[model samples]
Target: MEKIGTIASIKKEATIYKLTNPFRWFAKFGATGGLILFFISIVALVWANSPYQNVYEDFKNINLTFSIGSFVISKGLILWINDALMAIFFFVVGLEIKREFLVGELSDIRKASFPIVAAIGGMLVPALIYYLFNQEGDLRNGWGIPMATDIAFALGFLALLGSRVPTSLKIFLTALAIVDDIGAVIVIGLFYTETIHLIPIVCAGCIFVSMIFGNRLGIRTPWFYLIFGIFLWIAFLKSGIHATVSGVLAAFTIPSKSLVDGHLFVKEGKSLLNEFEVSFSKTKTIKHSQNSLTTKQESIVATMETACEYILPPLYRLEHSILPWVTFVIMPIFALANAGITIEGDLFRSLSHSVSYGVIGGLFLGKPIGVFLFSFIAVKLGISKLPEQTNWTQIIGIGFFAGVGFTMSIFVASLAFLDSNSLLTNSKIGILIGSLLSLTVGMIVLRFQKQK
Candidate 1:
């Protein structure tokens, strides 16, 4: 009977492993989010062009409301996704930005110079190109569109190249994208904002000040940040500073230092674990089943869990918990909500508009040129050095990859041409063309590079 049960358990474990193996492989590949984003985008494109286009429109326009004692927040489904969910996405981005500046690639001025300079060139050149093409009218507001980089898409493409690409290059791209996000947040705050409301701005300031004090006072609770963060978001939403900026601001206040040091955590953990083992042996006679943990064992387990929490910074904990949701759920929903646009009637003529021209030129031509040229100048001027083991050709190839600004470009397009559906459609079409070209050409360039 024991042998039969053991054999059954082995078969069950094998079945579970077989079921989970594919997901594990995908996660290991490290571009799972990008693949999902691409799939959602394709679905959106198809649905927009299919007979279900009306249904898609109806779904987007569906009204959603939240109210608390006559304080109401109401918006269309699309706006709710963009304004609410994307706030969460930006919050993650903010946490990443904070972490990078504090301890990651951007921590040291000397080591950070390369990616920082490269990112500056990346932003300035594309904005310049976009401005040149759209200088005449409201089209100029879209210069910020190509100034952004979709990090997930860019990094995902790099992940596909696998061992051929150097780790330094990936790190450089990651840092560059982060800097690009900072620029995007600033642009949205400065250029994209409408009329400013002083009352809400003051409210947001006071809330942020309280958060700063909380951080200094060693308050490490996630709930404290979450409650304050929602209020901050609401304040910014009413303050005319694009509520997403509040996400970043709130993230900056998260405690990056742990309550307990690693050494202390390990010592405490070992003691509790020892107690757990002793309790387990004592209870073994009373309860043969694994599920039948004694009170002492449960207390030990709870203590170990608390120790685990103490050793991890709130910033790291929040990011680790929230990133998967942002990547898998929020991003896919955002793509579905925003990427749907009908492609009909004189596609060439639509693509010929100055907005389209600016977007395509900025992303396809300007991004690589700006990134490579500025990098060259920085290296020549001795302001920065190339990433280790990365040559100039690889830099050029990465410049092309940086040109794949799908997500952020579409976001800027939505903001820039919100009043004009035709202009927004043109910009989206241009982004698709430009991003596709950049992705294809970048892959070709990197794939054919000679290994050193």
Candidate 2:
């Protein structure tokens, strides 16, 4: 009995030991962000539906503007969150996409095949289902609404599945979401755009050209891209293109190459160290107080700082710097701004409308069905395979989770039903219903899944 208890205690400690600090930190980060976002959504829902709804509406209506002489730009707070902050979010997305194409999962065609096909299935089927109901009306423009998957919500929800879900499953979902984002960007650009202003577009083209030229010239200063990016964003904003798309375009212009080679850096570093040692030895005899580093040491330190700067690529560094801000701050704000669908008398009655039914049915039924069917065919055709340790049941469950379209769906909804309050409200209702159903379905399925 003592031996068995001792072994059990050791095993428990071993399990605890395996949960590394970095993993724990990341887990907390994702969980906290997701929870805050969920909490804020609930707050928005309650506030929007309560007697204090006027306050919420007025807050959203608050205006912010920029101008120079006759040139002026003004927008509501909600629009700033949606149009401007979301652009920064898309910029990070662009960086991820570029990295994937260059070195991540999408770099290799074989590795990329499964997620790409799955994403295509996830997108097409939802849109088709939506189009089936919305055809021959202004609401037909909303086909794009059902197509985007909110990866943050999906991944965060996936994390709640705990150890029952394999890590590879999360990786596959992330890749699929990235591919899905690419599709969504294309849809927004081609379909959701307004009347074009050619001069601003021409100016945007010139800026983009200059950016590419700067990259070719090996001008790696971050400020150059930042300045040109501002111009590109403003031009796109004025050109009737969605300003967020400019963020993605700007990410493409960021330098991904390292400035100094390891060998050269090491050689110079060793030389600097030798000089530092000699200078330190010379200064040792004359040293009075340990106030700070000597002049030679400061020069070497500055040189070391520059070397460190050249070692890390700007694109990835920027991505890493902004990811937490986007995830925790911007995402929660977006939820607070957009997720406030007023739950008035008979919420289900509004959802019974065609647009509502389309979004609900497409997400709940079409997303899983399409994802599974397409993946099945892809595997059968020998073009793609299931992620390691993930089975068909888990895939089906994840497909349902992918149907939880909130952020991107609402953004598209805003574009689709800009002038139609009733349609927009109905669409939001569907989003709520579909997302809830999807979450319920996925969680139930995953929980009931047999463990190995």
After aligning candidate 1 to the native by TM-score, how far in Å is the CA of 372 from where it should be?
A: 1.1
What is the C-alpha lDDT profile of model 2 across 1-452, one tens digit per residue?
A: 76688789889988887877666776466456556667888898998998999999998889999999998989999988988999899999999999999889999999899989998999999999999998977889889888888888888878877887788888888898899899988998889897999999999999999999999998888889989998899999999988889999999989898899989889988988898888778777894434467877899989988987897788888999888899889998998888888766797789778899999988898889878889989999999988888899989998998898888888889889988978888998898789889988998998888776
lDDT of each: 0.90, 0.87
Off by over 4 Å in 2: 1-28, 262-297, 448-452
Q: How does residue 447 of candidate 1 score in lDDT?
A: 90
Best model per TM-score: 1
TM-score of each: 0.96, 0.88
For model 2, state the Cα shift of residue 60 in Å: 0.8
Candidate 1 TM-score over all chains jointly: 0.96
